[model samples]
Target chain A: MSLAPWRSRLTLALERNPQLNARYLQLATVGADNRPANRTVVFRGFYVDTDKLKFVVDARSQKITQIEQHPWAETCWYFPESREQFRISGCLTLVIANYPDLALQQARQDTWQELSDAARLQYTWPDPGQPKADAAAFESLPPNPKEPLPHFCLLLLQPVQVDHLELRGEPQNRWIYCRNDVNDWSTQAINP
Target chain B: MSLAPWRSRLTLALERNPQLNARYLQLATVGADNRPANRTVVFRGFYVDTDKLKFVVDARSQKITQIEQHPWAETCWYFPESREQFRISGCLTLVIANYPDLALQQARQDTWQELSDAARLQYTWPDPGQPKADAAAFESLPPNPKEPLPHFCLLLLQPVQVDHLELRGEPQNRWIYCRNDVNDWSTQAINP
Candidate 1:
């Protein structure tokens, strides 16, 4: 990866302790009706070589369907202590646990296994966004099977644009980094 | 306004102290390319009569342009302390300071005047999202004029759908309230 100065700065920001503003990332995706939807998704990791942000999701989630219909999405991350905001726009790709690519499939399995049993139970629930019969029914549902759920998938977001806003300055500082067709990044300082 | 049980619950949540979770609200709007964009916007107020969520914004902001292109938007707000999330989808309407309606215009003036001088100075800055020269140039710029900047706008989001999720439940509880053709809200329990 030919890291530009801004890219290096972003890398360092992400490398900071996850406890310090790296874990919770807000994801935005276009719904079926062409409206925008926003939700909080835990940040799994970032791949510097591919310039992709990774997260885990249940395959049956509404966001997964929205992403399939419209791959274009954005993520907004705010670090309250630093008073900095990062807005990232990109295309999303879903890698199923049983993908054809051996390396990717192994990576998905490793991620799934790394999750706590309680977290993995989320995928075992009924269809999301569907009407439920009763609150008690949730407890009576069958237990999760021994193997990993088939509905677990890894989502990778490859960013096309990254806008960083730092509110510490007198008038605030906004910077935009855009990736060119040749995979090189160009940076500019924009008005806040 | 015929308040449903869920609607009452939402109103109570918002009425809580601003220090709790009523101050910051996440806004989602579609970009020019039909991609979703998410950011945090302060919650100025909620209009029960009109069923609108009100906030302030700079008229020159990219979100204003995006709203003009596609008014459909959604806002997701989470209260970590309460473990509650409110997902609201709606159409946006911008009420300029010099609006035709006398009451609204007066309200706009009052809101603008109530803002601290430092807060109102944001509207006097150069166009947002545009490239800037240097950090020092911001300090050298002229002071904000006595009059309210024309770029200051009151944004009202009229909700068509409201989803409330409470994570305190064993399996979590999700309820969706959708507005029908006649402007009446119908509530349903959705699987979490």
Candidate 2:
């Protein structure tokens, strides 16, 4: 991933919404026969150095299966006030514990703090990732304390294409930016 | 469709926000490959007598194709002040003009006025409903004084499920209402 193009895209998105890093982003993955599945997760943080982005996922959600099937995904960040939207389509990678870092934990906590109590409860109990109480499956499973710990997994996305759509008046303004392997940005103006 | 369940879902959505009928809804549709495609359309008044909703759309958009191929689509309306969002997944209908209504035009014009001049100038032109160019597109096209007059097309939706997600604090709250029959509404709780 080229840092130049991503830096520009992230700068605009973050400038318009410094709080967006704390907002939830809806990640979509392709499903059977062209169908798509979506799930909203809090934004973990972005790594400008590695040109990567991270989010937590429960080990059991069907979304995990969808993500694993198709690593390519698109995310939408909708902002109401600015009537601005930032969309990116890219590839994802699941980060393992070998990536443990204090900085990443702090970033995760910052994003997590933005959620509501009920939202937190979804990840608070013995199993943070899956739907509550799978009686049929639970009866056959062994007792495991870490089961409820969300099996918290980190998913990273490296954006390949970014589009910024801003609504001001009649002819909406849109800027499309693409990143090349050489770490440069090519921009174009398209009719909105 | 079962009116009871549909109506219940609609009621839950409307009750959570009395202004839903007046607010703008952004519908996101994707191609068979799950690429992102979106358009801003109004929440054309819902049917009080039936489990249906309406919106004005240009036939040119790819959204029509996606909806035609796969009836399942999601619509989202975000309210920043309340830190709440309302989403629905449902089947769509291409409403013929024979449906008969005067408020339809009024609703469409009202929605248009909400758009900025640039957006209007760039994307919208006096509707001939046919493939006619904008003032600019027309100028580029050969002078043809004999083109057909513009027309408006209406799209309708029959919702199957509705989810209301409100973010209050550390956790979020969500309410799910499913349409069972014409007038039946089945309500359930889901993790936020």
Candidate 3:
């Protein structure tokens, strides 16, 4: 399938501002209480072919549970220096240690291995959001490849809609792209 | 009522990192479709006495409608320089031109006046989230004080729970504060 025209534009924008694109993005997911919950997650990369935004998270994180209950999620990413914001809403799919798909499991392992040892240490810690006795306790547990942290998970957000807003220009510039059933995108310029 | 100990700590943190605290924060609200939607909003300030977070938006914004339908919302704020993150979840209350409370209406008027004329231009534009014919059209229409933009609104988030995470530490530091019925806060250290 041909790439969506807006996808190329988004890719070029990211290329021009690599620092902003790679920085932390705020991910919003519907909580069990039906309220919207949000937290910062590092933006890994975007897959043009599949139209998926990649990010890594601990398998046992509360966000994973939230996404499991409601696959729909939205992310707000702002490039401070560029004065641009991208609001992306989509459905999520998780790749975990026991993911049924072999290819996805292998991909998760590769991503896990690429993380720095210090970063990987987080996944080995006790369950997140749970009360901890002491911060010092985590120091005892280091990243151990032999014990493979089953909690390491890869998250993929397949975007159905993307709203881009450039706040630098006069009157600002805003556009929204909605993906169709066949994966083609229809774009509309909206007032900022 | 006396301020909660945790609230004081939060206040101190914001004071120490004023730039990061005052910058744009990501606000998450559940949309009409029951999907979590997110966008960046300017951080106005925190009301120490009332324990509320304040921000202003056009009354006709989709988020205003979203909050009206479901008062519960979440805000994710990250301070890159400080390597800190704050996840605040709460119920929202709106202060509009015709709000019943006299004090709130006065507060909204004060905030509207404080905004720069260029910033106030947004309220004068056509309803946001709707398609527009031309971006240049907004340039022709300036903020007219006599024709008060009735759509200008102030939003207050009374946080029920606040999660503070400091990623600068070795094991990282995480704490959550939940406000009880009497407005007192209970704090717990959680695994990061």
Per residue, candidate 3 scores C-alpha lDDT tens digits across A121-167 of: 77767788899756556765667654448888889998889999988
Docking class of 3: medium
Quote the lDDT for B5 in model 3. 54
DockQ, candidate 1, comes to 0.68
TM-score of 1: 0.89
Instruction: Show where candidate 1 strays beyond 4 Å.
Output: A2-22, A135-137, A140-147, B2-7, B11-22, B134-137, B140-147
- List model 3 lDDT by residue over B32-148, tens digit each: 899998999987776536778889888787788788898899999887667788899999998888999888887788777777788888776766777865755675567765334
Better of 1 and 2 by TM-score: 1
Off by over 4 Å in 2: A1-10, A18-22, A96-122, A126-150, A179-185, B1-26, B34-42, B95-152, B169-172, B180-184
**Model 2 RMSD vs true structure:** 7.2
- Candidate 2 lDDT score at position A104: 58
Q: What are the clashing pairs of model 1?
A: none
Which structure is stronger by TM-score: 2 or 3? 3
Q: Model 1, residue A45: displacement in angstroms?
A: 1.0
TM-score of each prediction: 0.89, 0.67, 0.93
Which lDDT value does model 1 have at A102?
A: 75
> What are the Cα lDDT values of the candidates?
0.77, 0.57, 0.81
Cα lDDT of model 1 by residue, B1-192, tens digit: 765445676766666534533466678899888889888788776653667878888988888889889988888876655667888888998878678977777656666776777778777677788888566555544335445677788788888888998877788888999988898888898898
Residues B12-118, model 2: lDDT tens digits? 64566665332665565556766644444567567545656776665555566677676665666655445666666677765433335666544444544544443
